[model samples]
Target chain A: MSVLVVIECANGEVKKSSLEAATYGSKVAQQMGTTATAIAIGDISEENLKHLGAQGIKKVLFDNDARLKNFVNLAYVKVIAAAAQKEDSKVIILSNTNIGAAIGSRLAVRLEASLATNVVALPEISGSTFKVKRGVYSGKAFAEVNLTSDRKIIAVKKNTIEVGHEAGEASVENFSASLTDADFAAAPKEVIQQTGDILLPEADIVVSGGRGLKGPENWHLVEDLAKALGAATACSKPVADVDWRPHHEHVGQTGITVSPNLYIAIGISGAIQHLAGVNSSKVIVVINKDPEAPFFKAADYGIVGDAFEVVPKLIEAAKQLH
Target chain B: MKILVCISNVPDTTTKITFTPDNKQFNTAGVQFVINPYDEYALTRAIELKEAQGGTVTVLNVGEADTEANIRKALAIGADDAIRVNAKPTDAFFVATQIANIAKQENYDLILMGKESVDYNGFQVHGMVAEMLGIPSITPGVKLDVNGNTATVQREIEGGHEIIDAQLPIVVSAQQPMCEPRIPNMRGIMTARTKPLKVVEPTGSATKTEIDAFSLPPQKTGVKMISPENAGELITLLRNEAKVI
Candidate 1:
């Protein structure tokens, strides 16, 4: 059986998270001695879809419906289900994004497949039993989950796997689920895209600030450093709670959980709740004036300095790098 | 209008996660438990909606007898009544099945729950329940307003959010900025003691997934201290040594 990967794209390009999912699906297919087929969705071009061959995808299934540029849950699930049937895929993989989770859960039930979301590693298939490790307790712990059903749906966590690339192209073909008006009933009234150079979840470097940065007016320090480093800017819970930053920029237990390669936390006292979210970063650097700040314990690099003094120098240094 | 809020009992955010000696189960010996924070958003929003439209708010949990105290706490916070499905929460599949069974029979106008439990972080139940009952679901909903039989909800997407308007009898998972979660006052706490808490048997859907073991992440390496006077050096280290650039 072939493996089906749901690749989500936006702004006419495939998202980095979807690229990671494609790599994961190809690896799973490799393990099973089968080829991986991708069902391309969203507003990406077919030429870009062919580039999924770099992730080892053999063939690409394209849904030509323009309405798909906007996320329609029922319509997405129907297309994915149809693709899975056509490819005779026993395994389905997707990125654990908002759109992915929304459709993946419903697809699990509709396909009668056992689903494991936030899966960190590829599964170990031994005989008929499939085992995979997943993030639980909001990044506090990992649990080894065994999917008992033969049909398995795995939603790979973003940034967990290193994306694989090869200089090859996959053959693209048109595929349709033939939708009806009822499928678009819960369509979004409007889609607002957040305009930024870097998206936090997919960013390699993230510069975050806590209440330690003082007030909203002083946010330029964080933004300036992020600009120099070409990184996304984020905030701790209290900063977002007090309107110092937007809720979408908040990264913590109650907010977004980001696993960037390098997470530079400024003035943010590392609270347990905050750590629970960013603890998975490949490297953590904590900058706080208070030497006793709990975040220093989890940090790979610690600098006990006033942010107002240190950030400018850091930005200057980052500028010199380029 | 009838609203149902689903809450899960989870370890306090401050608790250090540790597994048993065999690494098979979470070590709950000294851990404190609290209502899943995300679920509290849904619980408070449902209470607020019920108070405005003059409807009943029912809090439901699919957990063992130990979860009853937390269920009562939800009732204290403002749920009109409570139901505890007596069974161990094996996985998201089993939990959603029980919730679907309850909602199917009761026919609640709105089914609300947290985006995901902090313990499992499954983020699966809302969609599964909505699919099981063949209803529209808006997940990780940041804003929700109800007028008559129509509900307007704002769901968080990647960067920005989307607004969706749906009819009554819909499922929505609560996220942050939805509504402020309320604490039970002495009067409400006292009243909750006499409120009806109905216990029901599990529907016994076979669990599709099982946790074989639990493990904490690897211990972080020791930090390399750098002086602020050498702030520029830190960036140099990040580029040349750390090679992150």
Candidate 2:
């Protein structure tokens, strides 16, 4: 059986997480003495599909059905299920994304294969046992899960793997999975757009404000810093609930959980609820006037000063970088 | 409009993390466990939907007998019935299998759970269960609506959010913005006592991914001090010594 990786694309480009999934799937394929096959979907261009070759993907199955353009769960799954059957994939890999985990789980049940999500490392294919280490307890710890079923699916966590671009002139091929009307239903009637410079999950850097900012009108200081640093903007749960910021920007236990590379919190006291959502960042910078703020406890670096003064200065300093 | 809500018992978010001598087990002494924070969103939303639409809600857990208290609490919060798949939640795969086995026998329209349990944070089970049943799963959705057999779910994407549609017999792993979590009140607490909690043995094989050794993260270093005024000095310290910029 071969390894199959599902690569998601948007506006003709592959997502960063999909690259990591391909690298992961290819390595798993190597362990099984086979090669990896990728199925490209969504609004991706053909040129981007070739990049999979650098990650050791030998073939790409492209199902460019217009019905599949959007993330219709049924349509996408039907097409992917078809590819997995055609490739005889004993292993399927995807990102630990809303789309990825959602599709991965449904696909697992459909195929009668065992599955694991939020996996942080490669599997230990010892004898008959195919096991993988998965993050549990919200990044607190891990557990090794064995897929007893012959077929298996895994969802890899983002930013956990280093994407490698092995030097290569890769080839791209197109294949089809004939989807019917039954495969596509309940298409989104409306798509709402929220304006922001960066999407929190996709951002390389994030600048967040909290109750410490004092009021909604003072948001400019935080926005200016985010703009100067080219970072996404976020707020603590309290700020979101109080309408200081939109609920979409809330990051905490009861809000969006993000794992960006760099997280900067300005004028926010770190509650455990907030920390659980963001403790996974590669680096954390907390700025609070209260020296004993709980946020400073978890921050890799911190600035204990007034946000009105600090944010402007920070923005000016960051502006000089480029 | 029936809903199935999945929850897990996890250590409180503020509990000091400690490990066993072998580092394989989390030291449970003096640690308080609560329903995973993520699952709270699912539970609250399920109850809310059932209250409005008029249907039963079932709470499922994959842990052993000790997890019954959480199951009961879910019932107190408005779930009609509870099921404890008597097993240790060794890993996501094991937990998913158990949920799938139990779900197959039920006629629920929607399956809901937290985006990721505060413990293990696998975030795989809901999707895996949906996959097992050949059903659609929408994860980390902040908003959900049910009309007849179709469900419209608003799931967060990287920067924006995506609105997706799926027929019933779907799974939704909930995050915040779905609804605010509600505290259980006196009347609901009184009614929770008689809720039927059925315990079932898991059907799938239980061998989890092999763990070589578990290790807690390195100890946190001393909290460094720099005067509030010399903020620029800290940057220098980071650039010169820490080299983290």
Candidate 3:
């Protein structure tokens, strides 16, 4: 039996989160003295599928049914089940993304595997018991969970694991699952692509702002810094609620939860709700005019200053890095 | 139309999280619990739909007696009846199994909940329930509209949103922009006390996962106060010291 990694591809390339999952799956496979095989979904090129070997995958199974390009819940689950059966996979790993969550849970039931989502660390396997650590309470606390079933499924949280880059090549094979018209019943009428290279969920570094940036007109401070660092741009709930930024960019309890390696928060008071979404960030840097801003207490680094002045300097400094 | 809205009771977003003395469970002594903020959106939207389509809205919870208050609060906001499955939530699989069993018997037209609970943050229940029933599930929904047996839902993707069309018998996990959650009015609150509240035994699906322990994230070291004038210096440290850049 091999470990199977579900690789999510967008725009004909593997997503950063999926690469992290591949890396994690490969590590888990190594610990089990087995190899990792990846099942590719969404849009991806054959050449790029082979490149997933960089993340330690030994082989790739892809469904080129053109119709499988967009996410169809049942169809995706069917494809994964076929792969799991073909590979005799006991452990399945995927990114804890929107697509992953939607499909992973269904696969757990269809496969009768013990399921764990939002997992942050590698599993600790001792004899028959396999346990994993996960973020819970919306990043407030952590829980060590033991999976009691023979088959297991894990949805790794984004940006929680470092991706391995051991250059290698993986063999690609085309596999087709039995599909019918029923599987396409819930397909989207249209797919809208976000207009940016960096996706917030996959971004390693995120530069975010809150209402302290003043208004929509002042969002340039956030955008410029993001551009300088090649990072994703995000905003707090207030900014998104007030229409200063798009809802997709909002990162908070009610929005998207992101755990980037380096999170830069500017002009945002650390609201507990806001922190709930980003508290898992590895290194948090807060820049606010108020020294006593609650976010400062949670920040690894703090700069007590005006966003107008501090952001431009940060941008200038970030540009010089390259 | 019959709509089922699921709600979870969780600590208020502002509650300072602390573990029990043994560090194995959440310390709930002084913490204030509220209807999960995201679930509020689902409850509000379900109520709005019921008003428009003349449907019965039912609120369901999987927890012990402590969660009944929030379930009743949901009734006061808009549901016609409430159900409390008598079991502490063990994991997403168990919770979803319980909900799916209840929904199967009742045959609700639409099932909705928040994208994820603020406490456990497990975004698995909706999909699992749908899978158990062999139905369609949409998550992190930003917009939803219904016309008889068809539903038009707008859900968040990585960059933008996708508008989907599904037949009746669908599960959707609501998020922001669905609608502003409504507070319970005095009249609704008064009427809620007399509404039918049903307590059911758990489906007894053994939890596949067990929590070994709980712990708070390590406290952040004191923030190094970097002067605004030398903001560039902080960047240097980030590069040379932190090596993040």
Candidate 4:
């Protein structure tokens, strides 16, 4: 039995979350006294596939099907399931991304494996039992889950596990599932990706804004500070609801959850819903004109000053650091 | 077009989360339950579609009797009828199985739900149900429009979005900006009291996973305040002390 890691790639490069998954899968493989093999999907180069070795993967399986470039839920599931069966994998790991969650859930049903998503830690295996800790209730709490099935599927939340770089190179092998036309039935007609901005979920640092930033016209304050820190930009739910930002940039209980290394909240009041999405950041910095803002309680550092004044100074300081 | 919109009754977003003494289950004693905020998007969109086109919208839930209030709230909002699978929603697979069985028997043209429930936050049921029913599923859908036998969906990705097309009999999980969730009117609420709410026994007998315990996240000790004039010091602390910069 082996561990199978599903590596998601876009535009010929591996996503940071998938790299974390590879590392987590390798650790799980080590704990089970087995090896980890990665099944890479999308239009990634073989050279990039071999880089999984840094995450402790021993072998890389690449399917160079042109049709597999974009995500097709059923097609990806068939390919991953084929890889798992071929390797006789007892444990399957994937990053808890939109694509990953889609494939992992379907694979669990098809393979009769117990599935867990938003898993925050590695599994604890003792004898026949496998247990994992996962965030639940929108990160307000966590649950320790026991997987009772013979086979298991885990979707690790991004930024929770630390990525490790070990010395080695993984051997790349070609694999095919012989996908049919039906597999491409639901393929996307057009995909529009943001060209230059850092993706919020994968960013190491995030700078977010709220209604206190005044209007969409004044959003450059948030962006300027983000640029200084080399961070991604985000906003609370209200900011997105009023068209100040796109829905994808909204981080809250009802939106994307991020766990970056640092989260800077400017003018955001730290609503519980908003906090649910960002409270997992390693360090939180809150800046608001209101001294009694709820976000201050959850923040590592707080500055009770106008964003109009504080953010520009912070940007200046960040620029002068190096 | 017959649409099945799944809803979950969860604690209000502002509720303070707590666990029982044993920590095996959530402490719901004082928590006020409402229709999950995300699912409301799905419910509202489904209602709007039903209004635009000519079809019936049915609301489904996997919960006990306590969930019926939210189920009724859904009915009041716009659904024609409701179904509550008499079960605890043990796990994603179990819940998906229940949903799939009903969809298979009824042959719903569209299955709609939130991307994930707020309570367990398991974003698995939609795909699991779609797989079980041999249908295509789109998740975190920001926009959905139906024309004839084809359905168009705008699905959210990491940085942007994708426009996808699928034939009839598709599953979609809704996200924000889809539509503003509607509140039930007095007339609708009065009519909802008479709407059919069928409670059926769960067909799935097995669950793949079990929750061992629940725990709260560690709280921040306290915030280190910085004077407004020394705002730049915060960045210095982030670099030197926190080492995060």
Tell me each candidate's TM-score.
0.99, 0.89, 0.98, 0.99
Task: Calculate candidate 3's fnat.
Answer: 0.81
Report DockQ per prediction, comma-separated.
0.81, 0.43, 0.79, 0.89
State the lDDT of candidate 1 residue by residue for B1-245, as single tens digits.
99999999999988889989999999999888899999999999998988888999999999999998899899999899999999988899899999999999999999999999999998999999999998888988999999999999999987678999888878999999999889999999999999999999999768889899988999887999999999989888888788887
Off by over 4 Å in 2: A27-34, A54-56, A122-131, A144-151, A193-196, B204-213, B220-245
Best by lDDT: 4
Where is model 4 more than 4 Å wrong at Cα?
none
Q: Number of clashes in model 3?
A: 0
Per-residue accuracy of model 1 over A1-322 as CA lDDT, tens digit each: 8999999887899889999999999999999999999998778888999999999999999997889888888899999999999988999998988888898889988898899999988899888879999988889999999998879999999877889888899999999898988777677998778886688878999999999988999999999999999999999999999998988899988889988889999999999999999998888999999999999989989999999999999999999988
lDDT of each: 0.91, 0.79, 0.90, 0.93
TM-score of chain B of each: 0.98, 0.94, 0.96, 0.99
Find the 10 residues in a row with the least total lDDT in model 1 chain A. Answer: A190-199
| Full candidate order by lDDT, most accurate first | 4, 1, 3, 2
- Cα TM-score of candidate 3: 0.98
Which parts of model 1 are misplaced by more than 4 Å? none
Encode model 3's per-residue lDDT on B1-245: one tens digit a residue: 99999999999998888888888889998999999888998999999998998989999999999888888889899899999999998888899999999999999999999989999888989899999999999987899999989999998887667889999899999888899889999998999999999999998767778888888888887788899999988888887887777
Which residue runs of candidate 3 sit more than 4 Å off their true CA positions? none
